[model samples]
Target: MSAAREHVIADLRERISLLEGGSARKVGCLPFGVPEIDAVLPEGGLAYGALHEFAGGGSGAIDGAAAALFAAGIAARTKGHVVWCLTRPDLFFPALVQAGLHHNRVVFVEADKEEDVLASMEEALSYGGLGAVVGELVRLPMVASRRLQLAAEKTGTMGIVVRRWRRQTEASDFGQPTASTTRWRVSVMPSDELPVPGVGRARWFLELMRSRAGECAEFVVGACDDKGRVDLPSGSADRSNTSGRSVYSR
Candidate 1:
């Protein structure tokens, strides 16, 4: 090969490598306030401009609700606007507000079917300026997920997938391979035991099942509040009253 031609070929190879590495790029992150998770995540927190999947550990409404709220909290962290596509209209606005995603900043798009929700998510991601695009789907195949991933990279928008299934059998679909940058299983954990006879803050097990350039880890933190912020882990709390935002009802 001629020297000039060889140099051109090497440059082309470098560009292809950069494109391939984009899947695991540390675009940006939203901190969780817990050191354990932050220590393991790339770029200090959850990365934006990539698709992250979250599914409930079990096949029930409570589990599904927890997973949805988990994703909502992340959506609340996005800049500009948030677009949410769902097959059902059950997202309680008040609960979302508590998680920091306000009604005014969020645009909810209701779809008749899960397939439609996925389609909307991809389309919404294509247009720039939105902080994030979230979709609730029962099953997201690898091909569909790759399209969403590519769209996020092109536009620098976060993509979140909340996996909630109508049938118990369909819950198994979460195990299928996907092109998502991260995969998580969020489930409700027992709330902290209050010293007084009153309910305590809701807790969740945020398990990182897959990360392209990070560790598979788990975090148990106080669930998100009205501003979409999670408290430091209860074990780390010096006192129950230490956290100012103690109103925890979901």
Candidate 2:
């Protein structure tokens, strides 16, 4: 932690940021509007002009729904139209609307294969005209992710990838290395207790599996509301459980 060593590290970070088409001096972020969640992210929020990956914690209906809603919530908070490229046309538009991304603002591209979906995402991101570009893919290789990351950075657009797998075996690919800025997993948790015989707000277990220049962490919070925001349970306890391991290289 000497001054000379610190300076070298800072210089390297700046150079890397520049190469990624962002400035170290002032980078943009998309805060979740929740203090506890934002604090865990290196930049106090999800970094803009970068690629992020999301996947279900397990091969369950609830797990897939939670992960998709998590990504949709983030996209809902952005400014322009959203380009969502997917190989399957099974997305529930009503669920996305409930999560705050209205149908009018989304342009869905149905592709025949995962490769096509990635190609469409890269093209949309490179267009520099949308608020965010989302892709549904089962496997995101390092090279493919790198191209998507670079395209997003050049336009200062957010790139999101939802890793969807039809079989349990395909889920293993999500643990592989990718060039994304961060990776996340979301699983459904039991709803909070209610006084009456009625359903309460949905809860979720969120895991920050990987991040660039940041530590991995996890949290349990209420699911996204109509405003694309999550709420911490009463008391806002710290749930920073991490194994100190990263699935991807920095």
Highest-scoring model, TM-score: 2
RMSD for each model, in Å, please?
8.3, 10.8
lDDT (tens digit, per residue) of candidate 1 on 61-180? 766777878888888877778998987787777777778888888898999987799899999887767878999899999999999999888777889999987899999899999999
Candidate 1: regions farther than 4 A off:
1-26, 236-250
- TM-scores, all candidates, are 0.81, 0.83
Span of ten consecutive residues with least summed lDDT in model 1: 239-248
Overall lDDT per candidate, in order of appearance: 0.79, 0.82
The lDDT of model 1 is 0.79
Residue runs of model 2 more than 4 Å from their true location after superposition: 1-27, 235-250
| C-alpha lDDT (0 to 100) for residue 41 of candidate 1 | 83
